[model samples]
Target: MHLPIELDRDRAEPLQNQLYEQLRGLIIARRLKSNSRLVATRFLAEKLGISRTTVLLAYERLISEGYLETRPAVGTFVCAVLPDLVPAPQINDNRVDDLPQTELRPPLFQSRMPVGEPVEPALIDFWGGPDFRIFPLKIWQRITQHVLECYGKGISRPPPSAGIDPLRGAIADWLAAQRGIIVDRDQIIIVAGAQQAYNIAARLFLQRGDRVVIETPGHAGASFLFESLGATQHPVPVDEHGLLVDALPDGSTSLAYVTPSHQNPIGGTLPLERREALIEWARGAGAYLIEDDCDGDFRYRGMGPPSLKSLDPYGLVLYTGTFSKTLGAGLRLGYMVVPQELVASTVAVKTLLDNGSPWLEQMVLAEFIASGEYDRHLRRVRKTYLERRDCLIAALRLHFGDVQLAGVDTGTHLTWLLPASLPSAPAVQEAARQRGIGVYTVSESEIGGRPATLYTENALLLGYSSLEERQIRDGIAGLAAALRDHRRAATG
Candidate 1:
């Protein structure tokens, strides 16, 4: 009997494993009838152009699972009685499932962030990704080789609870040089990324029902993290000047998280005066200020403001920085500059959460920074992104006559406020998505519920870091056409 078996050699799954799964599937689906004789292992192997041993292994798995029975002399046959298979319990539209749910001490709220995936065939993905083609791969390979050669056994050495020393020093020096912030190496703790750093901060500071402040129309994932910790949100609205320091409540908060340098969702840079005000608020309230400087590196127009930590005198600021925007998200490396007072406690918490980030990346990054390749790479990418940003602006102008753009002078993306002529942000987003382009509204980026005001109702965030100039122009043009169609349909 010729079994309809198709194997993909290109796939990562082992050939034997694939064969076993396929045979089991066929039996479970009842395509392979009960008591039906299966082809001999040798014959099947010859027919499938695979080793006889591969076929034997597959057959053995099937027999062990009771999907097939091998007779002493008569040949292998499908089992007369198939083993019971139960469909897996599924989470329905409501989060609750048929399976028994576990009760926890404090009521928990599970949340997820909407991540953008860029498929190979995607039309025009504005999903925030680094152009790996521009990454310093040649230089990286050399540095990696040097690190490996210099420290053979050191690679396997258990990393410090804080981080590898050289990396911490490099990070400190880079912060001083680039971001105008100087700190001891002991204060910098390496994390998986900004998210992990946030997790550590949440654990260290927040208690049940504690109030933590976040910006209005801010990143949902950030706010949701605190929310899940049983903290009540004290949402302060964000304007062109970043987080409103005046709106912050007096003396009753644990932490206040802000993305001051190129604020997430809505790009706003807090001025020096406002930065000072925020510091004072934290100082007075006895609250820790969490400054997530994820996109601080990319500034187009002029020298951006000094980092919040740079302005810190009282040591209330916990400054966070990530390699995601600089190197790439795949690096999964970020660091937090904790207050000297909180250093020991935070590092102890980090040890419990995760021993340390991977050693190879730490070693390689240390070398990269020491060799000044990281700075060089940053300089190169900054120029490319500036050109791309300009192209996007020009394209939007060409398609829709001089549209209003915000956060243009800095960061990988700028917010475009839709004119009254165009449709709402969601309508435009959906229409553009159908055209194989992604134009995200602030609503799409929110992890928590939407804030009170609708500052970004008609605003769309366009990330230009990963896209080439041509791609940016084409994507804008497509979005323009999509918006026009939407407008016409609505009018009719």
Candidate 2:
């Protein structure tokens, strides 16, 4: 049978890749049905004007990736267990004809913001937001088992709407001792993660058309949530120190979201003076500050500054902390220390949002923190991550010579400013990907929205926490080679 297979031999992509992509598209589009037989390699080669070896290699790759099946004695075919295709539903012509056509109303929110597609399994994911390789999984497993063994009977049922009391108490005590926020255990409301905590805060405070302040290049999740809730978001610019507090509007704002500890995307730590200024701004405007401390536990270079919530005398800050960075994103455990005045309202909102987080995980995490194991684990991983960060910086300098590194004083990743002679950030990212190395640029949504040319055009983000020291060096060398090649081609 003739199939719609085409190859571009002149393209940069390999012949095998072209063939694999065409066949995969056919299968996904359902042009090639499940269990349908594919033409023999020789037949396909002749039909497509490609060599038989190329066809054979492509077929082998497809089979290995689970898109095709090969029978020893018979032939190759589309996988029998492939998902069934659903045809598009038909629209009613008569109903459409009878309806009066009018101008459609503009949507209250902008069209959905495009998210970065998941990294292909074959590629190294240097863009993964948080490090998972160094997670204390063994220790966590032991703690989880201990919790189940000791508290199994109590957790068999659903936890209270406010979450397990002991876990809340542990979180409260931890915050008071570490974050300097004095709050009753009753004010601590546990949620799955900061995402859920944000949702709860939105529900409690935001109304349609309410104005909210967000960093210009802020967390996409927070931006999307505010947009989804019909709130108008005003983008506030961020500088080397952190958010520009002076840029905030003077009037009332329903909510202000800031990543004070380690700002997302840029990794700037908000200075103590800036933190105080932010608090004053929030108080004067009578707005709530949603402090997203997603990476508060991984401060490396210097003594970390105290949390903004700790200095908040007016109970204006809704302090949110997550274990996603310190522990793992999969754990999905985080807590918010609500001010005494907002406790009842926050709990009511939490109750409405999925009742509460799972009891078992919360219990186990609480026990982990209580036993002091969490602190020890942080100390161990922090050292390793700090070393990796330094290795990445040193390798970049050795290869590229005097590269400007930003956000290196803290956090799991740092941004390198490419020289004008090199290719742009996106160009560098794509070139590295071709060599099986993952390097991110500021323009990519993975780092947030298209960063201004000043911030993104000449910058690349290298996340070294998850990669080994050797891998880090190799990846940098690969990137340097790719950049050199690009420059040569451009001049030629």
- What TM-score, over all chains together, does every model reach? 0.80, 0.76
Mind giving the per-residue lDDT tens digits that candidate 2 earns over 1-492?
778777887899998889988988888777888889999999888888889999999899888778899998899999966644434345578675545543344445563453553547214546635556667789889988988888899777878878799888888888877777788899888888898888888998899999898885668788788878888888787866678898989898989999988777777889899999999998888799999985777788776788988888888889898888788788888888888888888888888878888888888888888988888888988898888888888898899889887677777888777788778888988888888888876564322233444566776777777888888888888888887877788889
Error of 1 at 60 (Å): 9.6
Best by lDDT: 1
Please list the residue runs of candidate 1 whose C-alpha ends up more than 4 Å from where it truly belongs after superposition: 1-109, 114-122, 445-448
Give, for candidate 1, the lowest lDDT window spanning 10 residues. 98-107
Alpha-carbon runs more than 4 Å astray in model 2: 1-117, 121-124, 128-131, 444-453
The Cα RMSD of model 2 versus the native structure comes to: 13.8
Between which residue pairs do clashes occur in model 2?
A: none
State the displacement of the C-alpha of residue 161, model 1, in Å, after optimal TM-score superposition.
1.4
lDDT of 2 at 3: 87
